[model samples]
Target: MIEPSYYLSNIVQELKPSGIRKFFDLAAGMEGVISLGVGEPDFVTPWNVREACILSLEQGYTSYTANAGLIELRKEISHYLKNLTNIEYNPHNQVLVTVGGSQALDISLRAIVNPGDEVIVIEPSFVSYASLVTLAGGIPVPVQTTGDMEFKLQPEELEKAITEKTKAIILCSPNNPTGTCLNKKELEMIAEIIEKYDLLVISDEIYAELTYDEAYTSFVSIKGMEERTILVSGFSKGFAMTGWRLGYIAANPEFLNAMLKIHQYSMMCAPTMAQYAAIEAMKNGKEDVIHMKKSYRQRRNLFVGALNDIGLTCHVPGGAFYAFPSIQKTNLTSEEFAEQLLMEEKVAVVPGNVFGKSGEGFVRCSYASSLEQLQEAVRRMQRFVESRT
Candidate 1:
């Protein structure tokens, strides 16, 4: 009989299963669980965007698109970026649409990382970074951020983490789990650090459209950083198109060319119907985005206020729909807090430790559910806190 352990790749063997999934599985089978665990938008894809997909199917536009994605969609993406962020890319050469920002990240890592090369990731960040870095044969050097700084990455922390083996920094603003956005001044400081080290930057701006107070800054828009920065974004969070599985990476032609090799060979183009729908989202979905942002802000205020009133300290999130509240007052570990909340309060939240060690003593609560659900979850949480007290 074949030895299955020997057949498994050593790289796969070394990777730990996702920490985020542990709570998800526990919450799954439980009855009456109100989950604020996942980071997906609560909105449906706008009716017009969904119609666009149906229209494409009606038009018999089901054949495979070019590996670089549809030329029309690429043009729309370039125009959208230029209009909003002042970043320019050629539709033909500098963009390769992929299977969501997740795929863009994986393909980018595959393109640039070599075994043992260090990739600096800011925490608490999106959970996929370390795993993707490892899969690309790189080391994930985490730079921890704190609640004192609203969980924003400090330039000094970044400076301490860098070494000669450092290949790239994965920058996520309107960061996941924490809902922290880096302002222009903060990004300028980061630019200085990047220039000093001559490092590559993979800026995940998937939540670009979700910033509450500040204009989103693209790393490529910074002076001298454009040539070395890869911008990863898509329709998932902002456009409520997560199920469409459409995302793209924009970089210099050379880097784009390299990424295209991996994208083409691995996944080819993103779904054709999704690309068609995305074109509609880019052209006519501005109002939809604004509406969603307003709802998220309202939810943010309600959730954060409830959390603070209940003795948890939560930062005023600048972007994204999450509230990362410190549960230290309860004297429960984040995991313990989360598990107990699930069991007793029947409310589901992600433990901060799932994001990183820096995330300990906190819990990530997404306000993406409805106003009623948000209100009810907060009520349950308040009762839970009182019980623990």
Candidate 2:
């Protein structure tokens, strides 16, 4: 008999399981639990897009697509990105379809990072960034961001975090947990740093389509940035196609080719039917996205106003369907507040500390649920906050 630990990779073992998943698991079986935990969209996958997948299957699209995904899908993505972000790509070599945006991000890190290289991660960010950087054999250097800045990464902070070993920076605009988006001006300032340092930028724009307050800016679209940027997006949030498991990355051919090498060996290709569905989404799903974004905006306003009225002091999220409110006033740690809310009030939200140390004393509440559900959750949370005060 032997211990598996003897042969296991320490990094994988040392990795903390996602706190978001842990909270979701705890609340999953609880009856009457109103979840503001997961950031999944409540919208059904658009009927038209789903129908496209069905038709593709009927037409014998069950076989694997090209390793880079369907040619037409890639071309459509090139057009979609060019029109929206004004960043043009050849499609033939610049687009690589992935299982989800996660794969695009993971493989990009694998492609670019060498052992012991440093990847600057801005927090509180999506959880995967740090772990993936580590998995890719790079050091994850976390830079703190405060809620006072709406959780936007400051250029000065980024500059201070960089060292000679720094190879890249991960930027998630319309950031997760916080739901705040970076504007063009802010991105330009970041671009100046990137250019000055000659660092690569991995811009995760998964929530780009859901921006509520202003025009979304593509980090790669910043002047002189395309050469050094890898843009990752997917059909999940905006298209409500999470189960479809479709995402794509666009970048310079050199980087994309390197990513494709890793993707081809590991994933081969994205699901064939999903590729077809995503093609339809790119071609005709704009109106559906617009409809969903409008719904999210209404829910955002409702939830934020309700939380503020109850003294939660939630940031007015500019994009994404999350409301990050400081729970500091209640004198409860984020985990305690979220856990008590679930136990006593049956409202489940993720503790902000799971996102990063800076996220302590706050909680991330997803507004992706219905207006009715959001209203009910807010009511329960209001009661919880009041008792604490």
Candidate 3:
């Protein structure tokens, strides 16, 4: 018999399991563990959105949607993007609904990446970017950002990473893990580099609505980027609709159509009921998102302040629900610090090294839990830190 390993594709066989899931799975079996490892919203899906899904089912709308997605949901997504970025997207050709933002990212990479193409992935970013690039037969060239740089990718660093074989860049803002949101000027500078290099951008803006300090800027909204940016977003973060498994991609028609082809063959369509819910979410979900964002902001202030007070030295994240605190002072690696903290204090966090090499001295803790849970987690973390000191 052939070895099991022989049956697996070389790429899939070599791919590492998600680092975020390692701690999450460990904490799952333990009692009384406060898990900040997963980047999920603690808020329940808004009642109105749920109701919309319920109504759709009750009205017998249970069949598969158009391969691209429900026309109505696509229209809503178009309207939402237009309002947010002042850029018009034709719902008919510019938007393709996906199973989730994850699938959108996957298919976007699949649609564009050719074998041996180099894709620049900014680190420490969401865990999937590099893996997806690899699975798509592309080389993931990591460009690490430093805490001193506030975790924002610098133009010079991006320029240095580019080579003749470089095909695209995957950018997440309000970034995951670090929660750094790039301002317009910062993005424009990067955009300049992209234009000069003539590279495509897979811009993950799932956390756009969660940005606290300033209005979110869409990459496609950047001058000359409309044709080059694959804008990926979903209802999962801001609308607390993760389980709904619905997301969308907006790009130039050429790119959109290419992604739609892959999505149609691979996913068929996003859940029909979820599409209904997303329609309502895009139409009437602003208030719910605003409320959630406000709550997250309060939690961010509390959690980040407590992290700093406990000497973990975290920069206040501008968006997303994570606090990435440097654990260098503990004289332990990120994994060691996180593992010991979980064993000693029942607090779960993802080691930053899993995100990328530059993430080695930090750990990511989600502040999306209740304020009470966050406070207790912080106290436990403080105790753990003191014990180490």
Candidate 4:
């Protein structure tokens, strides 16, 4: 019999499985486990959003939308971005609705990347960024950011990472795993480097609505960035609409058209009901987003405080619902710390190493669970830390 490797693409064969999923699956099989591994919202989709989808079904409006998606939904996305970022995109040509922010990321990379092109991915970041770059036939050059730097990409580091072969950079503010939100000043500094390098940016702003303390800044709103940035966002994080799998891209028409070709052949269109639901989300989901953001802020305070009190030093995350606390004091590799914690205390978290090499001494704990569950998880984590000491 032929080896399975002989039939598989070399890229697919060599790609490692998602590190986040490993613990999630282990926690799934355990009893009394409190999982802080996944980065999903704990809230349900707002009633109005769901009702809109239901209403669409009742009206017998289920069918594949136009390849770019429902024009009305595109218009809503345009209006939403305009309101949030103060940047205007022509709804007809600049917006492309996608299955999820993940798909938006995938197609955007595919649209821009060519073989041997290098895409700079700031680390520790969402696992998918590097993988998607690789899958798009580009070299994923990871540039590390440490907790000392609050995990924000520095302009110097970015400049060092770029070469003539560098095609683009992926920026995820209110970042996954680390929860580092870039402020306007910090973004402007990075924008200067981007301009100097003449590089494109695929800015993932899926967590834009979850910022705490300071307002979120859209990268495209920076002077001279509108044409160079591809904005990818979705309802999954803020609207608590993960299952809806609805996301959209706002970019220059040239980029949108290139991505649309791939999206047309591969995805065809986003789910019709989800598109309808997303329309309602954009129109009336502000209150829902605000409520969820407030709850996450409270949870962040509780969870990060508890982790620090237990000797795991954690930075105060400015946005998103994750706390990346240093586990170095425990004298264990990130994977070892996560694994032992799960087996001993029945609390699950993603090892920071899974994110990138600079993430080796930390672990990511999501604060998107209930307060009660977070409290219990912290207690268990304290116990686990105490035993090692």
RMSD (Å) per prediction: 1.0, 0.8, 0.8, 0.8
lDDT of 2 by residue, 1-389 (tens): 99999999999999999989988898988999989998889899988899999999899879888999999999999999999799888889999999999999999999999999999989998989999999999999999999788788889999999999999999998989899899999999999999999999999999999998899999988999999999999999988999999999999999999999999899999999999999999999999999999999999999999999999997899999999999999999998998888999999999999988899988999999988888898888888888999
Can you write out model 3's per-residue Cα lDDT over 1-389, one digit (the tens) per residue? 77898788988989999988888888999999998887899999999989999999999999998999988888999999999988999999999999999999999999999999999999998999999999999999999899987898989999999999999999999999999999999999999999999999999999999999888888889999989999999989999999988889999999988888898788888889999999889889899999999999999999999999999999989999988999999999999999999999999999999999999999999999999999999999999999988
- Pairs with steric clashes in candidate 1: none
Which regions of candidate 1 are displaced past 4 Å? none
Compared with the true structure, the alpha-carbon lDDT of candidate 3 equals 0.93
How much does candidate 4 score in TM-score? 0.99
- Cα TM-score per model: 0.98, 0.99, 0.99, 0.99
Among these predictions, the greatest lDDT belongs to 4
Residue-level lDDT of model 1, residues 110-177, one tens digit each, is 89999999999999978999999999999999999999989989899999999999999999988998
Please give the lDDT score at residue 361 for candidate 3.
Answer: 98
CA lDDT scores, all candidates in order: 0.92, 0.92, 0.93, 0.94
Off by over 4 Å in 3: none
For residue 49, model 1's alpha carbon misses the true position, in angstroms, by 0.6
- Model 4, 1-389: lDDT tens per residue? 78887899999887999999899889999999999997899888888999999999999999889999999999999999999999999999999999999999999999999999999999998999999999999999999999998898988889998999999999999999899999999999999999998999999999999999898899999999999999999989999999999999999999999999999999999999999999998888888888898899999999999999999999999999999999999899999999999999999999999999999999999999999999999999999999888
RMSD of 1: 1.0
